[model samples]
Each structure stands twice: as C-alpha cells, then as structure tokens.
Target: MQPGIHPAYRPVVFRDKVGGLAFLTRSTATSDRTVEWEDGNTYPVIDVEISSASHPFYTGQSRVLDTAGRVEQFRRRYGDRH
Candidate 1:
C-alpha cells in the first residue's frame, strides 16, 4: 500500500457496443470518452469489442467444432500410423 505511486481506481463504465450493454464498475483504466449512467452521472467509458454480454461462451452462441471431421481429414491426408 504505497501512496502517490498507484493508479487511481474509480467508477468507470464498460460498454459492449455489439451487445448494447453497459455497466458501471471500479477500474484503473482510463478513457477520454464519457457517458451518463443510470445514476445521472457521467463516468469514463471504455468500449470493448467483446464482453460477457456478447461473448459466444457467455451467450451460448458458440459453435461446437467438428473434431471428428477434422480427425478424419487428417487421417486421410496422412494415413494413421496406428
């Protein structure tokens, strides 16, 4: 716990544009852009490409890769040794 050597931690907004979601939380990250939150206050906003809101895993929209097909293709290309 050192004084004057740590970045300031304050309330900030994380915005997921693709998912159209925004949330307020404490972070050390900074941004020139700002947005008015539900509380009627402006906070530094950070735009993120992906977040839990829109992430495939979180949204349950992830595709299950066809591993069986890939394995068959590999074996066909290079005959299975075993």
Candidate 2:
C-alpha cells in the first residue's frame, strides 16, 4: 500500500429513504450530509434510491411479465408465420 495515495476509509451511513432503512458501514464515499447513528455517533449519510431492503428481487416482490399477452400482441401486429 502507498502512503497519501489511497482514499480514507471510514464508517459511513447508507440510507434507503423508500424503505426507511439505514445502516452503518465502512466506505470511501463521502457526503456533506450527516446523521446520528444508534451508537450515539455522527456519520456521513448517503441517500440511495434502492437497496436490498426495498429491491424487488430481495423482497421477493418481483413482477411476473405477461409473456402470453406479449406473444398474442406480436401475432396480432404481424400474422403468425406458422
């Protein structure tokens, strides 16, 4: 490892607003915003649009695509070759 070349790694907070979830972890990412954590310490907060808490795949809320409908639509648009 080189000195004075690597970004500082420190504890930071990742917030998922949609899921109302926040977690503290080490990261090189920085932010001007800050928040008080459960441990009574302040850390930089990063707002994220999606995380495992709210993600469809992780939450098992994924939407099932209507393949049959799509196939029928395609056939209607262009007569079936068969």
Candidate 3:
C-alpha cells in the first residue's frame, strides 16, 4: 500500500518453450522481450521451461518411481543393521 516501495506487478505472458503454450498473468518479473497478447497489447514475455500445461502431474502423465529397486538397494546397504 505504500507508494514507490513496491515493485510494479503487471501483466506478463509466460510461454512454455517445450509445450508451445502461452498465457497472460500478473507477475513482478521484468523482461526485455515482448509479445503481442490476444488483447492486441504488447506484454513482457518470459519463456519458461515448464508450466501446468506441460507438467506431467497436471497432464495426467505422472511418473511412477521404481521404489522396489530403491528399497532393495537400501536393504542391501543398511537393512542388516535393523
């Protein structure tokens, strides 16, 4: 609420490089690159490596860890003590 003490929170476009998706949202991050949004206004663009659109968990492609292998390895190393 104080004047000149807070960084400007403005609309920015976050583009996922791998997913090839873009969305507009407010952020405090600044960038030199700009992109014309659907509203026909240029907004600062921040290229991201991952986003909800391409995330495995959100896309229902969650990975299953091989816990059995890890458990066997742990048992071989430390299970004898317990």
Number of the predicted model whose TM-score against the real structure is largest: 1
Lowest-sum lDDT 10-residue window in model 3: 73-82
lDDT of 2 at 50: 99
Candidate 2 to truth, TM: 0.80
Report the error of model 1 at residue 19, Å: 0.4
- Candidate 2 error regions (>4 Å): 68-82
Estimated TM-score per prediction? 0.87, 0.80, 0.82
Ranking by TM-score: 1, 3, 2
lDDT (Cα, tens digit) per residue for candidate 1, span 1-82: 8999999999999999899989999999999999999999999999999999899999999999999999999999998897
Candidate 3 structure quality by residue, lDDT tens digits, 21-76: 99999999999999999889999999999998889998899999999999999998
- Which parts of model 3 are misplaced by more than 4 Å? 80-82
The alpha-carbon root-mean-square deviation between model 3 and the true structure, to one decimal in Å, is: 1.7
Predictions in order: lDDT: 0.96, 0.97, 0.95
